[model samples]
Target: MTTPDTQSCTACQDLERGREQAAAVRDRSKVTDFHVLIARHRARHPAADEAVNVMREQGPRT
Candidate 1:
Protein backbone atom coordinates (compact mmCIF):
# COMPACT_ATOMS: atom_id res chain seq x y z
CA MET A 1 0.00 0.00 0.00
CA THR A 2 3.04 2.27 -0.32
CA THR A 3 4.52 3.90 -3.39
CA PRO A 4 8.19 4.64 -4.03
CA ASP A 5 7.60 8.32 -3.44
CA THR A 6 6.01 7.57 -0.10
CA GLN A 7 8.98 5.49 0.98
CA SER A 8 11.39 8.18 -0.18
CA CYS A 9 9.53 10.83 1.71
CA THR A 10 9.65 8.77 4.88
CA ALA A 11 13.40 8.30 4.48
CA CYS A 12 13.90 12.01 4.04
CA GLN A 13 11.91 12.73 7.15
CA ASP A 14 14.01 10.30 9.16
CA LEU A 15 17.20 11.91 7.86
CA GLU A 16 16.03 15.32 8.93
CA ARG A 17 15.19 14.05 12.38
CA GLY A 18 18.67 12.57 12.68
CA ARG A 19 20.30 15.81 11.57
CA GLU A 20 18.24 17.82 14.03
CA GLN A 21 19.08 15.46 16.85
CA ALA A 22 22.78 15.63 16.00
CA ALA A 23 22.73 19.40 16.10
CA ALA A 24 20.80 19.37 19.36
CA VAL A 25 23.23 16.99 21.00
CA ARG A 26 26.20 18.99 19.76
CA ASP A 27 24.89 22.36 20.88
CA ARG A 28 22.93 21.38 24.00
CA SER A 29 22.52 18.82 26.76
CA LYS A 30 19.06 17.69 25.82
CA VAL A 31 17.74 15.67 22.89
CA THR A 32 14.26 14.38 21.93
CA ASP A 33 15.23 11.88 19.25
CA PHE A 34 12.51 9.30 18.64
CA HIS A 35 11.20 8.05 22.03
CA VAL A 36 14.52 8.22 23.83
CA LEU A 37 15.18 11.49 25.56
CA ILE A 38 18.71 12.41 26.55
CA ALA A 39 19.25 15.12 29.10
CA ARG A 40 21.75 16.44 31.55
CA HIS A 41 20.78 15.03 34.92
CA ARG A 42 22.88 16.49 37.71
CA ALA A 43 26.51 16.81 36.52
CA ARG A 44 26.82 13.66 34.46
CA HIS A 45 25.64 14.94 31.13
CA PRO A 46 27.24 13.23 28.16
CA ALA A 47 29.74 15.08 26.00
CA ALA A 48 28.92 16.03 22.42
CA ASP A 49 31.40 13.55 21.01
CA GLU A 50 29.92 10.76 23.06
CA ALA A 51 26.36 11.43 22.07
CA VAL A 52 26.26 9.23 18.95
CA ASN A 53 28.02 6.36 20.70
CA VAL A 54 25.61 6.53 23.59
CA MET A 55 22.61 6.52 21.34
CA ARG A 56 23.94 3.59 19.32
CA GLU A 57 24.48 1.54 22.43
CA GLN A 58 21.12 2.46 23.87
CA GLY A 59 19.36 1.66 20.55
CA PRO A 60 15.59 1.60 20.21
CA ARG A 61 13.37 0.46 23.03
CA THR A 62 10.23 -1.60 22.50
Candidate 2:
Protein backbone atom coordinates (compact mmCIF):
# COMPACT_ATOMS: atom_id res chain seq x y z
CA MET A 1 0.00 0.00 0.00
CA THR A 2 1.22 3.49 -0.82
CA THR A 3 -0.31 4.92 2.34
CA PRO A 4 -3.90 5.69 3.21
CA ASP A 5 -3.60 9.33 2.23
CA THR A 6 -2.46 8.15 -1.18
CA GLN A 7 -5.16 5.52 -1.33
CA SER A 8 -7.96 7.56 0.21
CA CYS A 9 -9.33 8.11 -3.28
CA THR A 10 -10.26 4.48 -2.64
CA ALA A 11 -10.47 1.38 -4.82
CA CYS A 12 -13.96 0.14 -4.47
CA GLN A 13 -17.43 0.48 -6.00
CA ASP A 14 -19.04 -0.01 -2.58
CA LEU A 15 -19.53 3.45 -1.17
CA GLU A 16 -20.26 1.92 2.22
CA ARG A 17 -16.88 0.24 2.43
CA GLY A 18 -15.06 3.42 1.56
CA ARG A 19 -17.08 5.47 3.99
CA GLU A 20 -16.64 3.00 6.83
CA GLN A 21 -12.89 2.68 6.64
CA ALA A 22 -12.54 6.39 5.95
CA ALA A 23 -14.54 7.35 8.98
CA ALA A 24 -12.80 4.88 11.29
CA VAL A 25 -9.33 5.99 10.34
CA ARG A 26 -9.90 9.72 10.54
CA ASP A 27 -8.31 10.14 13.97
CA ARG A 28 -5.23 7.96 13.42
CA SER A 29 -3.59 10.51 11.16
CA LYS A 30 -0.15 12.02 11.34
CA VAL A 31 1.28 15.50 10.81
CA THR A 32 3.09 14.66 7.54
CA ASP A 33 0.17 12.73 6.10
CA PHE A 34 1.10 9.16 5.32
CA HIS A 35 -1.53 7.59 7.50
CA VAL A 36 -2.08 4.41 5.53
CA LEU A 37 1.57 4.02 4.72
CA ILE A 38 2.41 4.38 8.36
CA ALA A 39 -0.27 1.92 9.27
CA ARG A 40 1.12 -0.68 6.92
CA HIS A 41 4.60 -0.02 8.16
CA ARG A 42 3.57 -0.42 11.77
CA ALA A 43 1.84 -3.65 10.92
CA ARG A 44 5.30 -4.94 10.17
CA HIS A 45 6.76 -3.38 13.35
CA PRO A 46 8.47 -0.66 11.34
CA ALA A 47 7.59 2.18 13.65
CA ALA A 48 11.33 2.61 13.97
CA ASP A 49 12.79 4.84 11.29
CA GLU A 50 15.63 2.44 10.65
CA ALA A 51 13.26 -0.35 9.72
CA VAL A 52 11.27 1.85 7.44
CA ASN A 53 14.47 3.13 5.90
CA VAL A 54 15.78 -0.36 5.40
CA MET A 55 12.53 -1.45 3.81
CA ARG A 56 12.66 1.52 1.50
CA GLU A 57 16.26 0.88 0.61
CA GLN A 58 15.32 -2.57 -0.62
CA GLY A 59 12.11 -1.34 -2.29
CA PRO A 60 8.87 -1.79 -0.39
CA ARG A 61 5.56 -3.52 -1.13
CA THR A 62 6.87 -5.30 -4.21
Highest TM-score against the true fold, candidate: 1
TM-score, cand. 2: 0.22
At residue 23, what lDDT does model 2 achieve?
57
TM-score for model 1?
0.30
Deviation in angstroms for 12 in model 1? 0.3
Give the per-residue lDDT of model 2 (tens digit) for 17-59: 5445665777333322444554554466423456668878999
TM-score of each: 0.30, 0.22
Clash-forming residue pairs, model 2: 3-37, 4-36
Best by lDDT: 2
Q: Candidate 1: list runs displaced more than 4 Å.
A: 1-8, 27-62
The 10 consecutive residues of candidate 1 with the worst lDDT sum are 34-43
Q: Candidate 2: misplaced stretches above 4 Å?
A: 1-33, 46-62
